[model samples]
Structures are given as structure tokens and as C-alpha cells.
Target: MSLLDFDADQLAAFAAEVRQDYDVLKDKDLKLDLTRGKPAAEQLDLADALLELPGKGNHHAADGTDVRNYGNLAGLADVRGIWAELLGVELEQIYAGDSSSLNIMFDLVSWAYAFGTNDSERPWKDEETVKWICPVPGYDRHFTITEKFGFEMISVPMLEDGPDLNAIQELVKDPQVKGMWVVPVFSNPTGVTTSEEIARGLAEMETAAPDFRIVWDNAYAVHTLTDEFPPVHDVLGFAEAAGNPNRFWYLTSTSKITHAGAGVSFFASSVDNLDWYKSVASVRGIGPNKVNQLAHARYFGDADGVREVMRKHADILAPKFTKVLEILEERLGQYEVARWTEPKGGYFISLDVIDGTASRVVELAKEAGIALTGAGSSFPLKQDPNNRNIRLAPSLPPVAEVTAAMDGVATCVLLAAVEKLGA
Candidate 1:
């Protein structure tokens, strides 16, 4: 019977039983983590060949620019061409940067703050109150970046397909709202992909800020857990058609596609946006690691090579994600105390415990020696109004460890719900 179906005395009895199980779990002293979605060691090993690449005395780029020395501020034309194909853009529009895509993103936004984009009349900092719209249950780091820059963060609901467009259309009325953050495909936690309608709507929507931008973070463009290769909507193309050619700043990385730490990051925009980005980038540093960029070029000869690499990652990751789903269903399916996303691709499973019990569930799991992402981490400022969301990352650990941690997690969920009902 359901906990809600029980009378006061019965609820009390169930709570006592759950408490006993909790005590037993505590005695076991288990230690496991399901925090961030870090690529597993096996996934990183796929790009190990890049280490010995660009063989000695062969540092000449396809354009004849020696990568060992500094120059090509926009990156080697050959590497840019490879990245342009991956990003679905013209070669001149994309700029390959250092290992971290987040670094490139940070620099872009920082430049917007300091100097603004081509569309803006003045720097973003000139505004009395700059803000950004963020889809909730998003990547926490995105919110942190905007928040750190003193941009007021506004949360918009994330729906089955993507963000609620109605909310975004309304939020952009404020000229102070400079832009929004989007994961585009295989989004973090929920794994929500921007549909054609949603993508088109976002690109064409009118905004008060002429400089309003779409931080199009296509972090998982090619990451598919299933066999189907979903097509990416050409946001840049759509925006250009909408007469908003300079409205988007596209970003991507080889972080998950190749080596996590050593991967090259990329950004693509319009001709004007290109001038803005490269101009700012030139002042910040000389150039990205063209040597590593060259190594990546050789490793992934073309877009097809990237697809093959992701296939290998899916082969290693799909089973672990499946195992997590299986454990969640077996242990908690009957109770209905919790529900979780069965993501098709991307790095995490977004789980929602009974309202008011999420934080307690994580607390109980911690005492049992399992560390889950803090409850509400999926929301902006790490605040979930109902305290119901928890993100589970199965990629970092082996399948067996994922199983063990999830089992304990389910137990904690049930116990927390029962205790709450009894109280």
C-alpha cells in the first residue's frame, strides 16, 4: 500500500521500519560518489594516441604555418575547417581555442562585459542592471558564470522538449537582459534537446536588447547513447534568415568527444561577431595550442572520425546508464516515491524525489556513505523551490559501483518519504 494510503498509526509503523533500515545502512559505512559527470578513465583512454601525434620535425600546418612558433591568432586554417564542419558553420566563423571550452566561453562573456558585441551601443557593464535568462535544471556552472559577473539570473521552466518559449519570449522584453544560456543538444541532467520549433522560435524571437545573444553551448552535438544520429538544427542559419545574424555565439568542445582535460574548444559566430571575438582574444593571448590542435586534426581526420570516437564512448557509457535505470526501477518502481529521467544521451540522470524530501534523502544517503549531488543543484543558485531535484552521474564510476550507490540512494528516498508522511 502507498504511504499516503496509510492511517496515522500505520504511517508511524512504516516510519519505524524505515528508521531501522536506515540504522542498518549507517552501520555498513559505504563510500561512493554520484556527483559531477566526469568522463570515465576508459573514455579518456580513447584519445591517448593524440599524445604522440604531430611526430617530431613535422610541425608544419596544412597552411604551412609552423605550429611550434606563434602567429595564426585565429588558429590554423586547417583545424578551423575541421571544427567548422563539426559546428555546422563556415570556416571563417569558427575559432579554435585552448583545451577548455569553458575558458573560451568565459573570455567571450568577459569581453561582452568589457567591450560589448557589435550590436550593442556600449559595453554590457554600462547598463545599471544586466541580466540573463537560464533554463532551470541546467548546467550549474553556467549559472555560476553569469552570477559571478553580477548578472541577475532568471530561471525559466524546462519543459519536455526544451525551455518554455513563452517565458523566454516574455523575459527578453527587458533591454537589460543581454542573453540566455542554452545546451542545445543532449542537455545536462534532463537531456533535453532543442526541437526544430524551439530552435527556430529562439533564433527569431524579438528582444528589447538588440545585442541580446544566445550562448549556444552545443556541448553534446554528437553524443548519442542510442544508434540514431539526431540532426542538429542550424541555429546560425535560422538566425540569419530571421535577420538576426549576429544574435548567436556558438560554442563547442572536444571535451567529451576526445580527451576531457586536453581537448580543444571552439566558438563560431558571424563575420562581425568574429571580428569582435578575435579582436578581444588577440589582446588576451597569442593563440591557442596549435600543436594540440594539429594533433587533434590528425586524430580526427574529419567529422566522420569524430562520429566514430563518440560511438566508442557510447559503447562504454550506455551500459552504465542502463544499469542505473535498472537499479532505480527495481528498487523504487513499486513505491513511486521518486522519478528519474532515462536519458538517451548526455552525462546525467535527473531524479526528483517526493517534494520536501529531496534534501533529506541526500542527507540520509550521505550518512550511509553515498554522496549524491546536493538536492536542488539542478536549479539556479542551487535552489529548487520544491526541493525535489537530484542529478545522478553514472559516467564517473564503473557499473557495479553505480549499482551499489543507486541502491543505497533508493533506500534513502523511501525512508525520507515515509518519515515525512509520518511526521
Candidate 2:
């Protein structure tokens, strides 16, 4: 019988039984972790060619600039050309940078607080307070960056299409709202793509803060599980045509496409915005690691090479995701005590447990020898108001282990729901 269909007394009894079973299970002490979203060792091995890239001797860029020496603060032109094709942007509009796209984001935020973007004259720090709109069931790392800088984060509810446009529109009317972080394609945890209509709407929104920008971090742009996944509409172009030339700042990386620590990252925006960014970034460093850029240029010969490599990733990730989905369906589908996303692409499946029970279920799973990303991690400041969301990363585990882990997770959900319902 489904846990949701149970009467109060039946649920209570079930909870008691689960508690007793958990105690016994804990004694065996098996160890398994499904916490971080790191790629498996096998996945990392797929990019072995990148290790010997740029060959043993060639270390100069297409423009005759020595990669080992420092000069081009924006990055090598050939590297920018590579990302231009990948990001569907013009070569002049793309900037290839260091390993961390997160570093570029931090710089943008710092600039907004210190010097301001093209449209606004005053620095954000000049104000008494600054606010940012964060779509809930979002990426924890995204929220961490904003919160660390002391921005008042307002939670915007997420729907299957994307973040609620009504909420975002309403919130942006406040001058205090400076920016919003978006993962438009295969969003973190939820795996929902932002709709074209909402993307356009976001670009056209009438904002009180003239310097407001959309932090478009498309981290999983090429990481799809299926061949039929939808195309990502270009928000940068949409915004420009809608009369806001500098409305969006898009960032992406080859972290999953190649080596995580060694991959190159890309940033794209309008020409005006690029000029402003270069003026500030020039003071930061001489330039990004050119040798790494040269290596990626060699490894990905052209745009098509990137597509060929991504297809390989899909082959490996598809089975793991399928196994987790099947296990969840077999064990928990009938319960109605939880609902989960059936994503076509992306790194995670977001599961919503009964209200007030997500944390308890995660705790229960841990006792039975499983580790999960802490409950509430999908929300700002790690707070899910309803306490019902849990992000499950199934990509790192092998198919057999993914099956076993989902089975354990389903049991914990039912047991926790029963306890919360006082059955």
C-alpha cells in the first residue's frame, strides 16, 4: 500500500517499525556516499587525450604569442574562437578565461558593488542594502556566492518552465534588486529548462535598477542525457533585440566536457559590457593560463569535436540516470509520499518529500549507511521553507550501486513521512 494512502494509525505503526529496523541496520555499518556531484573516475578518464594536448613542444597561440609568456589579458583568440562556436556567440563577444567560471562571476559581483555596470552610475555598495533574486530548488553554490557578499537574497519559486516570471517581475520593480542567477539550460538539481517566453520576458522586464544584470551560468549546457533534449534559446541575443543590450552576462565551462580542474571557461556579453569587463579585469592579472587554452584548442580541433565528445558523455550518463529512475518508480512511485523530477538532461534529480520530513529522511538514510547532500541544500541559505526538497545525484555511481542507493532513499522517505503524519 502507498504510504500516502495509509490512515493515521497505520502510518504511526509503520514509523515505529522503520525506527526499529533502522537501529538494526545501523549495527551492520555499510558505507556508501551519494553526496557530491563529482564525475566518476571512469567519466574523468574519457578526456585522457587532453593530458597530452598541445603536444610536447608547441606552446604558441595562432597570433604568434608565446603561451608560456603573459600578455593577452582577455585570452588567446583561437581559444575564444573555440568557445565562440560552443556558446553560439561571435568570436569578439566571447572571452576564454581561467579554470573557474565561478571566479569570473565573483569578479562581476565585486564590480557591481564597486564600479557598477554600464547603465548605472552609482556603485551597489553606495546603497544601504542590495538584493538579488534566487530561484529556489536552485544551485547551492550559486547562493553561497551571493550570500557571502551580503546581498539580501529573495527566493523566487521555480516551476516546470523555469523560475516564476510573475514573481521575478514583481521583485525586480524594487531598485534594491540588483541581479538574478540563472541556469537556463538543464538547471541544477531540477533539470528544468527556462522557457523561451520567460527568457524573453526576463529580457524585457522594466527594472528600477538600470544596472541590473542576469547572471546566466549555463554550467550544464552540453551535459544532456538524451538525444532529444530541447535547444537552449540565446538569451543574450533576445535581450539585445528587446532593447537591453547589456542585460545578460553568460558563462559556461568545459568542466564536464573535459577535465574539471583543467578545462577552459567562457564568458559572453554585448560589446559594451565586454569593454567594461576588460577595463576592470585588466588590473586582475596578466592573462589566464595560455598553455591550457592552447591545449584545449588542440584537443577540440573545431566545434564538431566538442559535439562528438559530448555524445560519449551522454552514453555513460544515460544508463546511470535510467537505473535511478527505474528504482525510484519501482519502489516509491505508488507511495505518493514523494514526487521527483524525470529530467531529460542535467546532473541531478530533485525529490520532494512530505512537508517537514526531508531532513529526517536524509538522517534515516545515513543511519542505514547512505550519504546524501543535506536536505534544504537546494534553497537559499540552505533553507527550504517547507523542508521537503532533496537533490539526488545519480551520475557518479555505477548502475548497480545507483539502484541500491535509490532503494535505500525510498525507504527513508516512506518511514519519515509516516513519522511526520503521526500514523
- Top lDDT hit: 1
Instruction: Report residue 317 deviation for candidate 2 (angstroms).
Output: 1.3
Instruction: Tell me the tens digit of each residue's lDDT in model 2 across 1-423.
Output: 788678778777778877676666566575777887778778888889878878777987888888998778778898789778767788888888988898889899989789887777688888888999999899999999899889999999888999899999999999989899998888989999999999999998889888899999989887878765457677878888888889899998888888887888888999999899999998877789989998988888887777777778889998988888887788678877888888888899899989999999899989889999999998999999999999999878887788777877877887787777765
lDDT of 1: 0.87
Error of 1 at 329 (Å): 1.4
Q: List candidate 2 segments past 4 Å from native.
A: 8-28
TM-score of 1: 0.97
RMSD of each: 1.5, 1.7
Candidate 2: residue 417 Cα off by (Å): 1.0
Best by TM-score: 1
User: Which regions in candidate 1 have their CA more than 4 angstroms from the true location?
Assistant: none
Each candidate's number of clashing pairs is: 0, 2
